[model samples]
Target: MIIEGVKLMFVGMTTVLLFLSLMILLIQFVSFLTRDATARELEAIQKERELQSLKRKKKKEASADSDEDIAVIAAAIAAFEAERFART
Candidate 1:
């Protein structure tokens, strides 16, 4: 009788384990399906952000070049003004 009970217990445990493993696999599959679309969307957003960063960098470079040019012009004007003052 004890042997029979042990066998029955083993069978029950085996069945429970199998069912649990199956459930875990199902859950993982469903999660993958749900997140796959979101993952693609996140990738697209990341690409857009990188593109925006590049554009900002270009703009900053352009502004810096313009600022340098303006400084050169201002310095030239200042020198011209000093020369006129000395002449007067």
Candidate 2:
């Protein structure tokens, strides 16, 4: 009985190892076939990311410029109010 169990375990382990090795080989073969397509997809994704980053940067710069303009306008208004109060 002990010998039978050991033989069963060995067979099961060997079968599992064989299946895993074949799966690995199949994956390698598929990857080799699709390598060019995968590279193109990666390049396109990178370009899209770069464009999005550039758009975000431009938006940030515009927001900063607007903040400066608002500060200038507020300063002008404050000066006008001070002058008016002084005249009164």
Candidate 3:
């Protein structure tokens, strides 16, 4: 009975480790795909979208903007509309 329990424990541990490794690999693959953009063009596109939304939001609001809002807008514009770092 003791031998059987030991065997089962080992099997369970091995299975758990295998499952954990597979999960780690899947997470890594997903992150890589999320971060990758073809020739960095997609990053530019995404930044443009961010800037457009920020503009629309600012236009619709009449309240005074804080430094945070200006900073965010600047960041979006810098990311999207920079000619020096064009994705070629």
Model 3 gets an lDDT of 0.85
> Candidate 3, residues 5-81: lDDT per residue as tens digits?
99999999999999999999999998788675654888788999999999988866734566668889999989887
Assess the local accuracy of residue 27 in candidate 2 as a C-alpha lDDT between 0 and 100: 100
Can you give the TM-score per candidate against the true fold?
A: 0.54, 0.85, 0.43
What's the lDDT for all of these models? Answer: 0.98, 1.00, 0.85
Question: Best candidate, lDDT-wise?
Answer: 2
* Candidate 2 global lDDT: 1.00
Candidate 1 or 3, higher lDDT?
1
* Model 2 lDDT per residue over 1-88, tens place: 9999999999999999999999999999999999999999999999999999999999999999999999999999999999999999
Single out the weakest 10-residue window by summed lDDT for candidate 2: 50-59
RMSD of 1: 5.2
Clashing pairs in 2: none
